[model samples]
Target: MKALVIGGGIAGLLAARVLTETCDDVVVLERDKLSDVPEPRAGVPQGRHVHGLLVRGGEIMEGLFPGLYDELVQAGAHLMDAGEMRILNPLGWVASTRTGLPLLVVSRPLLETHLRRRLTAKIVDDVHVTGLSFRGSTVDGVLTRNGRVDADLVVDASGRSSKLPSWLAEAGITVPEPDVVDSRTGYATRLYTAPPDFPVVIAESLSAPDTPRGGIVMRIEGDRLMVTAQGAGGDHPSREPEGFQEFLDSLRGPIAEMLTDAEPLTPVYLFARTASRRLAFEQTPGWPGGLVAVGDAVCVFNPVYGQGMTVAAMGALLFRRHQDFSAKGCRDFQRKVAKIAQGAWALSSNADQSWASEHHAPGPLKRAFGWYMKKWQVALTHDQDMFARFVRVVHLVDSPAALMNPVVFRRLAKYSRQDPRRGRRRAGSNPR
Candidate 1:
C-alpha cells in the first residue's frame, strides 16, 4: 500500500515511521525546504522556543526509532532524572528526590534532526499540498502544487495551519467547530552558553488567575542552553533584550538570577500564537476512507504544559493498534484520537479557563479543578511523594486521578488551605 503523509515535523515524521511498518511506499511531503542541519524551519516558529517531550512522548519516539535515545545523548542531548529537575510553583519550590523516570532534554531542532535522519520513509521537501484528491467518494490522494499524487492512505500532520477542514468542505463535507480555550499566551526565547553549574532543567510554574508569568531554562544538544520566558493574558515577554531581562526578573523564583552568569548567544525571539484548540473532526458525520488526522491538525495545546508533543505522540501510537484502512476503520481511529487527546485537552484548556478567557467559561467543575490543583501546588511544596505523583501526572506517565486519591486528598485538605504568599504556611525548607 502507498501512504501519503503531510508535513515533516515530528508528528508527520513519527506517523510516517509508523506507516512504514505496513506500507511499502510511505512518502512525507513537507512544504518548506528542510535544512540538512538541525535548524528551525520557517513553518515551525515555535521551534525557536523551549520544548520538551513528556516522558511518554519520549518513550513513544524511542520505540519508533530504536537506539534513538543513545544517539541523541551521544550528540550532546541530556538524559536527566526527573527528580533532579527543579520547579518553582506558586506555593514554593517542589522538593526533589529520585523518581527513576528520566527526562530526554533536547531542543526541537536537534530532536527533529535525529528523527528525520533515522526515519525510513521518503521525505520530499518544498512540496506544498493544496487539497485532498478523491475517486468516487473515496480519498484517492492529496493534490499538491505540482499535481495530484495518488495514494491509498493519507495522513494529515500538517500542524496548526492545516487546511483539512476547508478541503473537506470542498468535498461537500463539514466539520464541527473547534473547542477553543485561548489564554492569549506568548513566548520570548533565547539561546545561551550555560555556566558549568547550571541546572539541566528548571521551570517556574505559570498558571492563570494568579501567576501569569513563567519561564524555563533547559540545557540541550551542543552544550547550549535555551531559556524561554512566557506570559499569559496578553502580558507577553518582550522581544527586546532589555525588556526580556526585565520580564525574567519579574518571575517569582531564581530564573533571572540563574541566568546572570550565562552568556546569550542569540537575540530574544518572540512567538505569540499559542492557544488550546481541538477540532472535532472525529465527530464529523461522514469521514472518508484512507484518511486520518494527527497532531496539531486534530488538536493543539498550550506549549506551557508541554502536552502537545505527547498528545501527538499518543495519537501516532494509535495507528499501530488499528489496521483496517476502510472508511469505518479511519473513522474508528479518528474517534480514538479524540479520546487520546481528551486528557491533555482537559488539562491545557481547563488551565486556560482559569484565566479570564473569552474563549472558555470556567464553569464550576473547571474552576474547582483549577483551584484544587493550585492548592495542590502549595501542598507539593512540603511533600516530595505528592510532588512525584503530580510530576508523573504532568508527564502523562500516571493518571491525574492519582493526585486525587485519599492520601493526597487528606494531605491537601490539611496543608493546602494556607497560601505561602501570605506568609502563613511557609514552614518547610524549600531546597533548590
Candidate 2:
C-alpha cells in the first residue's frame, strides 16, 4: 500500500509511523521545512509554550518509538514520577504520591522532531498540501505545491488549523458538522533558567468559585523552566514582565514567591486561541473512501488541560490496533478515533463550562455535574486513595465513570466525616 500523510506535526508523524507497519511506501508532506534539530516552527505557535506528555500518552509514544524516551531525557527532558507530581485542584494541595507512571516533560517542538526522527518514511517538508486529489469516490493522493503524488491512502494529521473539510468538499464529499464549545480562555508562556539546584515547583489553580488565578512551572530540556500562566473565560495573562509577575502573585502562594526569584529567559509569549472543539466526521453521511483524519484535525481541547498531544497519540494507537487502510478501513478508523476524541472533548469542555458564570451559563447537566465535581475534589483531599483513583481519571488512565464506583464514594464519605475540617481545607484549597 502507498500512503500519504498530510502535516508533519506530532500527530502527522505518529500517523505515518503507525501506517508504515502496513503500507509498503509511506511519505509525509509537511508545510514547514522542519529542522533536523528539534526547534519551534512558524506554523505551530503553541509550540513556543509549555507542554508535557501525560503518563498514558508518554507510554504509548514510548512503545511506538522505543528508546525515544531515553533520548528525550538525555536531551534534558524531565521525567516526573506521576505519583510524585504535584497538582492543586480547587481543593487544597494534592500530595505527591507515585502512581507507577512517569510523565515526559519536554518542549513540544523537541518532542515532535524526536518522534519524527524515528520514522523510516520520507518526509517532504516545505510543501503546502493544497488539497486532496481524487477520482470518482476515491481519494487518489494529495495536491502539493510541487505537484500530486498518487497514493492508495491519505491521512490528514494536520493540527487544529486543518482544512480537511474544505478539501473534502472540493472532492465531492460532505464533511460532518462540528460541535464547538468556546471558553474564550487565554494564556501567556515564558522560559526561565534557574540555578542548577533551584526548587522545582509545578503549581496551578483549578477553575472554581471565588478565585481563578492559575500557573504551572516545570523543568524542561536543559536548565530551563517553562512557566505558563492562564485564566478562565476572557481573563488573559499579561504581556509585560511586571504584569506577568503580578499574575503569578494572584495565585495561591509559594508559586508567586518562587517565580519572583527565578530568572526569566524569554519574553512572555501570549496566545489566545483557547477553545474546546470536536469534529463530527464519524456522523457525516456518504463519507468517501481511502481518506481519514486524525489528531487536532479530529479534536482540539483546551491546552490548559494538556490533552491535545495525548489524545493525538491515542488516536494513532487506535489506528495501529485496527490496522485499517482500505475504504471500509477509513470509515471504521474514523468512528473509533471519534469515540476517543469524544471522551477528551467531554472532559475538557465540561470543566470549562463550569466557569462560564453569566458569561456562558451551561445546560442543566453541566451545572449539576460541576457542583458534584467540587465535592469530589474535596473528597480527594481528605482521602489519599480517593485522590489516587481520581488522578488516574484525570490522567485519562481511567474513565470519568470510575468516579461513580460505590466503594470509592463510600470511602470519601467516611473520610469526610472522620475529618470535616481537613476535608473543607482540602476542598477549598487550590494547588499550584
Error of 1 at 66 (Å): 1.5
- lDDT at position 301, candidate 1: 89
RMSD of each: 2.0, 2.6
Total clashes for model 1:
0
User: Could you tell me how far off, in angstroms, the CA of residue 250 lies in candidate 1 after the best superposition?
Assistant: 1.6
What lDDT score goes with residue 291 in model 2? 87
Clashing pairs in 2: 83-97, 83-98, 88-431, 91-427, 91-429, 92-426, 92-429, 203-432, 204-432
Cα lDDT of model 2 overall? 0.77
lDDT (Cα, tens digit) per residue for candidate 2, span 47-166: 888775777788888999999889989988877767666666665666556677677778897888888778898898898889888777788888887888898888898888999988
Per-model TM-score versus the true fold = 0.96, 0.93
Score each candidate by Cα lDDT: 0.86, 0.77
Model 1 regions lying over 4 Å from their true place? 359-361, 417-431
**lDDT digits (tens) for residues 292-326 of candidate 1:** 99999999988888888888888888878888878
